[model samples]
Target: MRLLLATAAAAALFAAPALAQDPGHDMPMPAQPQPTSDMAGMSGMRSMMSAALGDYAINREASGTSWQPDASPHAGLHLMQGPWMVMVHATIDGVYDWQQGPRGGDKAFVSGMLMAMAKREVGDRGTVQLRAMLSPEPFMGKSGFPELLQTGETANGVTPLVDRQHPHDLFMELSGAYAYRLARQDSLFVYAGLPGEPAFGPPAFMHRLSIMDSPEAPITHHWLDSTHISMGVVTAGYIHRNWKLEVSRFRGREPDQHRFDIEAPKLDSTAARISWNPSANWALQASWADQKSPEQLEPDENIRRWSASAIYTVPFGHGGYWSTTAAWGRRTSAHGDLDGYALESAVRPNLDWTIFARAERVASDELALPPGAHGPAVTVGKVSVGAVRDFSLTPHWSFGVGGLYAINFVPGALRASYGRSEPQGAMGFVRFKLD
Candidate 1:
């Protein structure tokens, strides 16, 4: 029954304070304040009821730490009363894939989430917010049928296959926002819902289009910053102090429809970002993106891209820390064309271990093949490595484990009928948290 109406809407949103403390109240009753460890203003009341139930409010703060580098025991919950706020998060994972088929079957996974936010506070500096969210559905495991395609076949291709099931990616989002507090470090934040879709770097875990924690498999290429399925995006940003600025615009259609012409004229994307921290350990970031795609039929073919990256962090001794990053990019298309470069590193010998590595090289062109198709249309090099650990076991809770490996050198019938060379893979995960 749709998992019993999503477990009775997550037990009536966590038993709504025991149904508002019922006891046949007649009046007098007000004394309940004491619970602080900073929950970021109750995570903005579940992002204002998930932007009034249209979804997409994905994180406005509710706790921090774990910005990936592999460390997940997961812990987050924020609750507030007055204007209203509520947030909940849960995660369970165990994935092991060594590739082969049945699309590499599966191994283990589980995930859950719930969110709500509502706000009003319209004095002094103004405020208005609304939001909502829910998630569940992800599972995998099935693969056995290749000994050279099961010899001459006689049935019993290792059994397993009764219509094979395991594929899910559920979603929901709603949003609305208005803010003003142009002081105390500055603020302006104007929002328009249908948000969720910000998975930069590492191509969001090498692009599988993220969604795991059992929302029914397909994880990596990072996509659950709370789900923003399509179109409509506008952001104007600034952060003073350590320096930060942003400009954004993302119109619509292109979340894996693989571009089949949605009447064209709606893939206009623009982005700009700048970050700086001149001293104290030094820091810097720069970004730019542009996607036109509207006029086609020849005439220079349209479709362009550009990229750049740089990072450096050093602390050493005592608590230990070290970092490095480098990146470069280019792209053009009528069908395909690309150029790439990358380098990465990480180290942290204390506070619960850490280590990382990366290398990359890419060259492509072959704008939609089929005239003779030989080698060298360009396609080469790739590599990866990973490790992470964190154990806080108390003061609330924590746990984690990680592993990763990837490779691609292209070859074999031009990387087996290339769809952008895909081979060599490895992964592992485990996490739990409560605070």
Candidate 2:
């Protein structure tokens, strides 16, 4: 029944609005000739909503390539009418894995997403956009998918998540924004979402091409981009050419165990981010958030978190690119403060081979323990690499089988019971995508 309701909601969302926006209406416009200056007045809003601008309105790459390195790689379906454009972005990632660790489990599951965005001219110098995103994760079981030492959120009702990535809720975002042009290169906007992300962290790791091939969440997910699923958010921003500044009010709490339900929205937290693209090949961002009780088990705590990252992408042979990212994150709380750092890269040297690697140093408190003892804060380092060869069966379908290997540098306190500082994991997968 839950699945049914979710499916209905998605269908309704997609169908209803699209019909209302159909350009088939018989209404005719009564127009008078406008001066060239007046036509030029709306350039700012047009630049933001124009298809010629590639699909990203917010981040412009370093050298101004149509491909925005910071934006997620996507296969889109689009429609352009008079002064409006509508689009859909979707993907799914799944894998089979085997791993050795205190908090690791082997399994097969997919992480999938469907997002839609629609924009239209609001007035002479104004534009409005609506965005909706959804995911289905409940069928994967209660304990959640595997990772060496990821921890955050809750699962199976009231149980704190430890060393595993929790399932995303059915609805990830349902938001809207209004933008007004201030000048040829300037725009101001206000955004609100029931369940939306704030201006913090690198675009969710899952969306970064540098590590898109990796199925596991980064071990340092909580320290950086956990708020990508915040239940309520409102953001205000200013965009001028290749730079943007944004501040947000959002619910700090991560989603609870019920992946099928939309939790209540709370505006108990705040965050700010500033990003710039010096050239089309590079994008840099820095952000901070003051959050309250983001984790259920750590209810009394408040977290002041900071993150920064540099992302670079250079287009190459056959719809491929070399993408890389380096990021740092820190979280300060009453009990202690910890830091996390990550570097990763992905390259498709040729049409047939896709390769990627990542290294991370994470601070963990949830798994810092001995057989019969509790230990101090500990930091662990993890590294992984993988490759896939494409065998195309059709233009939109292909078969891919890949392998990955990961090793961990366990802290001394955990070395005793965990046996050795090194625990290993590997995975194999078959993938599908739109061309």
Candidate 3:
């Protein structure tokens, strides 16, 4: 208990200085007029606003255009100016699993995110941005699944159960960048910072909303959430008036492991991507990534690794869009493989209503057991579907509600260790914006 208290005190001491710094402090600047361009319609309006807002207040300045969507008032205050704008955001999520033991105990997962972002405009050219996020890893309620424990084992064996109630996965990051105009209609932008991993596709449904998070075992299977600080660089180029190319490198530790023991050499990541917009209403994108061990255990060996992915998006008719992504990866030297896919579509027949649906699948290879153990390799599959409704309660505020159903499949021993088979579950949330 004394140790725990000491640790808490140390963390508080470290964070106190940062909290003392005023979050709303900003440099004063003279007002400026918006820019102008030859392009007609929405494009011209955006160009004008981009010039007027300069770099620091683009997102908000752009909101002034009549055709553009209103800015999110809930996004919080801007902390900086110039070609860069800094802001903060907070979010909360709740999850419930209907599949429990014969006793029919339901489970609950709750999480939160506190993040700061910096966006820089590369002058009149383009923009760059970085973001840092802090949050608790995923955690489940005590009344959750009990069958996963052997007769003698207890919930204490599951770290998230205890860590969640307190605070365990304390995480933070800093990153963001912008683009520069290279030609009449072309621009180049680069960004580096802590971000999500590009893993499983649509069917896997492993990464619900957390873009940089992993959707594997301890995370998806055991219900433990993990976050890591990663440094990354991304370069994007616009060409042919309709195509965009992107490539990036991320260097950082892996997620969900003991920090001190983590091996830094093994922490390297790379990604390449391309996107094409045939028309104002139609666009497509594809990307790939190579990720090494985030935690370098044996600087020489025992490093986790993997590479894989494919994605595409298409729009049909007015306000209707469809997207699909697939990926396959293997952990070097480990008996782990990941294969998954996802498909989704959304349509807005009118201004008041929107409809969307998604389906996904994920599978993993078996891990080689240690000496004397009797168990087959591990494999898992999951699926989920849901819909969201956005209602304009007021000119400045919009509300939304959503629900989802998820299913989990696992072999015996793996199921026993990770509570592999979770029945269907659901979630809901509300959002507000200021502008």
Candidate 4:
């Protein structure tokens, strides 16, 4: 039923929007009048977006309000109608996964995300933008798919999910923002969302150029980017040249097992982040947050999280680029402190092929214990490699197939439970996307 609803929603979203064109793949589309002004104006529609401040390309914007390397490549369908510029991005993956260990399980599931954005010039120095993001992850089941040593959220209201990646909420983001230019190189902006991301970690893994092609959740998700789906958030920021500083108030509680409904909003959490683009090829950020009871299972716990990340991208031939990301995150509370580290990279040799790899180490207390049990955090690691080959289906669509192999490292103390010190996992997937 959830899948059916998602399918209906998708049809409406895609069929009712303005005409779309392949913005990144060089697919042919009917010619349209191009914009003459640097800003969105009455000139006509174009297959592009612009920055809110300086008259620059819009590829710098990533998930939420985060920034990626300015030189990163974008894969989506874009159009401009009148004064409003619109963009649509979507990805769907059907995956078969297997984990080889006593604690492992296998499953076939579908995971997908859809996002749309519209922005226009409010006046000479102001810009207003609206965005909506949705997902069909509820169809993957409340417990989500198998991921070795991946832990967070709940499968049912009463049990903590361990060794699995829980499904995302049906609604990921519904937000709006307005920016006012303060000078030639400066702007002030405010954003508010009923369900949106705060100024937290790096752009969520699925939005990062380095890791977006892989259909697996990072073990470091909780320590770094789990807050990407907060129930409520409001942020204010200042951007000058290539630097940005922002602060947010948001709801800290993780979403419950019920994946189809919106929960009550609370602004009990606070965070601050600073971002910089040293050049077109490099984007960097550091952030801190004080979250009040971020876990539904641990309502009394308060955690302080810190994260730092750097992303680099270099474009080469037409529709080809190399991207890399290195990130570190730590969370501290009365229970203890845990840290996670990650590095990932991807290279698109050309329009048809992409190669990607990721390595991560995370400290987890959930892996060595059962539900409701307590134990010291154990550090575990994983490394994975994969590749995808895409075939263009139309001017705005592409299909691809890929597979990944991963090795998980377990500590000696927990080897008995897992059956091996090192367990292996693999996944094969097919993807469809608007390119």
lDDT of 2 by residue, 56-141 (tens): 43323211111234332333444333344555555566678777855556899877676666666776677776777777566676
TM-score leader = 4
Model 4 ranges off by over 4 Å: 1-47, 53-55
- lDDT per residue for candidate 3 within 113-183, as digits (tens), equals 55555544445566554454554442442223322211111123233221012222334344444556666
Candidate 1's TM-score: 0.28
| RMSD in angstroms between candidate 4 and the native structure over all alpha carbons | 4.0
Score every model by TM-score: 0.28, 0.82, 0.54, 0.91
Q: lDDT at 365 for candidate 4?
A: 78
Residue 26's lDDT within candidate 4 is 33
Clashing pairs in 2: 61-279, 61-280, 62-279, 62-280, 63-279, 63-280, 64-280
How large is the C-alpha RMSD of every model relative to the true structure? 21.1, 7.9, 11.5, 4.0
lDDT score of model 4? Answer: 0.83
Question: What's the CA error at residue 206 for candidate 4, in Å?
Answer: 0.6
- Rank by lDDT, highest first: 4, 2, 1, 3
Clash count, predicted structure 2: 7
Q: Candidate 2: where is the Cα deviation over 4 Å?
A: 1-75, 81-83, 101-103, 350-352, 370-375, 391-399
The best candidate by lDDT is: 4
